[model samples]
Target: MANHAKAAEYNNTSISSLKGADRVRKRPAVIFGSDGLEGCEHSVFEILSNSIDEAREGYGDRIAVTRHRDGSITVADRGRGIPLDFNPNEKRYNWELVFCELYAGGKYRNNSGENYEFSLGLNGLGSCATQYSSEYMDVTVYRDDYRFDLHFEKGENSGGLKKEKCHYPHTGSIIKWRPDLEVFTDIDIPLEYYQTTLRKQAVVNAGLTFELHDEYSGETFEYCYQNGIVDYIKEIGGEKSFTEVQFYATQTKGRDREDKPEYKVKLEIAFCFNNEINLLEYYHNSSFLEYGGAPDKAVKAALVYEIDKCLRNRGKYTKDEAKVTFADVQDSLILVTNSFSTETSYENQTKKSITNKFIQEAMTEFLKEQLEIYFIENKAESEKILEQVLVNKRSRETAEKTRINIKKKLAGNVDITSRVKKFVDCRTKDLNRRELYIVEGDSALGACKLGRDAEFQAIIPVRGKILNCLKADYDSIFKNDIIVDLLKVLGCGVEIKSKHNKDLNTFDLANLRWNKIIICTDADVDGFQIRTLILTMLYTLVPTLIQEGKVYIAESPLYEIAVKDKSYFAYSDKEKVDILAKLRGKYTIQRSKGLGENEPEMMWQTTMNPETRRLIKVMPADIEETQAVFELLLGENLSGRKSFIEENGYRYLDMVDVS
Candidate 1:
């Protein structure tokens, strides 16, 4: 133990002692795992896991996560606090020891059969790993009438807890850590990402209050869901709902199906199928599968099969009926499945719980029992819902028919290729090197094409104001020439025809090829509208493109300052002010009303040139919040969009173009 302790000690180490960030560079994976957003998410996961573990141990209820002003993070929890003691002979406090030492925590007591049972930080290296990866870590502990504090710099203990006696004391733990700049090359934490996952956690752990503050943007939010996943389901499926029914089931391991080795499996699932187009499925831990595992698969399969069987018995489903896939089941359904296990194993680094195979069998039976009772008790309502399913079946068939016609149009098997002539496509087939600039008008398109590297950049000019496909259906979309051309260029294959020869007119989803899709419309109101239209279509129809980071918005300079023989570009009003101040000599300031205003050379220099162009990358901070906003803005209802615009339009409106 002494040898191990001595080896773990980095007593003389300092931030300056390391060579060129090698401290974090040497063990990059130990900190973020990899150098990307995933690693950044892993850091967040570590903090969240620690907080959740504290909550699970009944030591904390309130956890506060703050995005510090200095690209750091502080997650403080009201828990029993990290232990601080010494092997009187070792002459060190346990809390301080834990801070610098790896594999040192009560979470690993499972080997000893200690009371510290389940936890999110089972590896016992979570905090230590964080400390080692961070440039600095401040840990303060208040527990059992004593207060303890410790600080570390670049994986080395910089200071120790003060031994002074205190007048008052509280019980909790606070960890403030700054991921070493040397470790993580990029530092862009989106508040929405944290909000989404944390809010979900609050819902999964009923009564667990989670608070988040983004000092960068002066934004803060608190989440506390008393009803847990039940409320979560209701939130997602707002107006899309059916008969409200909650099921509670418990099955002792041996008494139930003799499938696997376990003591007991207990869980609760709440669901209500609605008329909405999307399915809302929430997974969890603690009576919920945090990262849905085998149990989720088993439950879903059983429910769909049972629904098919029950409907068939009632003469509602035909034997030759197309088997409704999971995607079909989710068309208008909101489901929350909670599977609890005495022993839980995570599938990946994010610690998404996936343990116990028999859980699926157990959950299947539970869902069957509850759904059966529900169907029997509400036979009329169930039958009505089934009728709705039949309607979906018809709509799907119609949509499928439309799909075939579009395929022929896209495949170039007929004269439909003429419809795509408006697009100025690049000759390059290399997806990684190719980019598309959806310019507003012919003038901007001409400038972009002239300024672009013809080898990879493609320019497509929209004729006047483009059609807004927000509320448009497949038929409406298929009729629009602009949408058809864009779709054909994107390589999202045309819709295939049904078995029966019919003009279904559907959009094919396989033809998309451009890796970098930039919406380079002007910075004015019209440009904003065009951008919105394109985003709405892309987000609604092909979301994976955005998810995969293939979409971006080009930042065109609003102000071009030509002083003497030199020219400078300013993207924002503040930048213009600063640049004008820097160049005090006589100068001519020109405001670019739109992309069309810029000459080909100026356009390339300021917006189209890869070497100098500025681009805004969209990232979600609070997924749930984003979803709510998207629904409010782009949903079928006009009231939500109107109310949202009324409340927040001022901030969003481009004042420069608002005239």
Candidate 2:
């Protein structure tokens, strides 16, 4: 077996062009950033988003989604039906043109005819993209007393638009389509996902009722939040607020610049210092942002500044006292921020983050003013809040010192890698070729050190399981010696390591010490638990490493079968059986209890040799699913974990060991 790089430069590459729907199918990841289950989910959201945008633009308020049993989805909204009148510009019905054209929609401009003050779809690739990837799409629109129907097969018009009388007597839009199996990996719309998304939309867009009927599951769910973000905060963060500091604020500022289009910005924020962490979700035009942008940063800054200012005014601390940090502010802050921008700039094609520069200044001013008013009106509660802030400030100060000390102690230096007793590092300074193997115990580390290509591979040993980061905070990660050592060795410092003293989310990935991070633990039960801990830590703490395909697990052999003079490694019991049957000879089988039990040469042959070794790549196909599993198993709750073990523990009875 030979190992090669997929990213190597190939000379004389031919330039090509992919146009129309064929272009979308050729490079799906260019539009969706993925072709996995997440892409399928996004397809559903892209269609639903158009309907949601119509409601946002002062249309009908009801939006419904149905998950059919035959791998089909139907999204219906009682919103203003898509423009059905003939378009003189395109020389076709507006409805047909909108569905067929790639970059055709009402979201681009703000004119009186088809003005969209707030919109989720700006690329004009929402329903059209869905239609392009679907086997067939059927669209029905009703406006006044007329009903218009249009159909498409893989984004092309099946025939032409048909007009008829409206018997339903309602003005709305219905889009029904089944994903083309040839184009997608899977088309099944997950029920739990739809339920959560619909509920979240209802929370963001108040007065809008969202419903989901999963025919496959034979269940119906609906969401209607009249109080909107404020109510959503209380529901998730609980009614009991820290010092009873619970309130909502609206930041509405109109822009009337002649150069720019007249824009109405709606910034709705609900805040509660409940001393509990919940779904502190951020949104812009109802699109959920996993890594929040300017608005989220602004809100956090405002809370820290305003609270610190209020405390200083009361003469609670000396001028020399340390200012509060984001960790201090966010520790107890349960918030829901919904920013509606008439025109928005995003960092990527997925629209995961807003890059608007005005959001930071606009939001910070609004929040600061609101907090100042809250403190002045409720002086007693303000004192209680100040007390908690003092406690947090003390903890943060102590943790900061400890974090710096640990960074120096583990790495023997702060920025550059220095020789450490525990880590047997490689010689090469090239980051790309460098590999870091985190082994379970000293024995496995010794084995790795002996067998490894010393020019590239480095080994660090852990005594036992490191903290499961799913349940650990920055303080826990900073204070623990083992966790600190691991972070220092990796050089991708956990949350507490920031040059600018920013929050965990701002931890820079460019500082990563190694190009490849491989878990080389023992082949046993305890080793599996250790690997799980390391995986959870990396997945939650430094997700960029996993997303960039730097994380892997070395698969050590489970059994060594000696037949005659040669030995063959078997990864599973099935493989062992096959090897024995094919050899047709009496062989002695030794079950590998641990990597430590194997010889250095044996370890190299079975696991370390890159050419033939089986390295299982840990790619997080769906991060949301991965997070849910980790939380359920590694969270503070014992009941859910216990129930899971009791019901599914048998699956692990015949499991293979890991390296």
* Number of the top-ranking candidate, with lDDT as the measure: 2
Residues 77-116, candidate 2: write the lDDT tens digits.
Answer: 9887888778787687676557766778877763455467
The positional error of residue 274 in candidate 2, measured at the CA in angstroms, is 1.3
Any idea what lDDT model 2 has?
0.78
Each candidate: RMSD to true structure? 15.1, 13.7
Which pairs of residues have clashing backbones in candidate 2? 521-659
Deviating ranges (above 4 Å) for candidate 2: 1-16, 110-114, 243-262, 400-659
* Total colliding residue pairs, candidate 2: 1
TM-score of 1: 0.60
How does each model score on TM-score? Answer: 0.60, 0.60
Off by over 4 Å in 1: 1-33, 87-93, 110-117, 167-169, 249-266, 277-279, 286-291, 353-355, 413-659
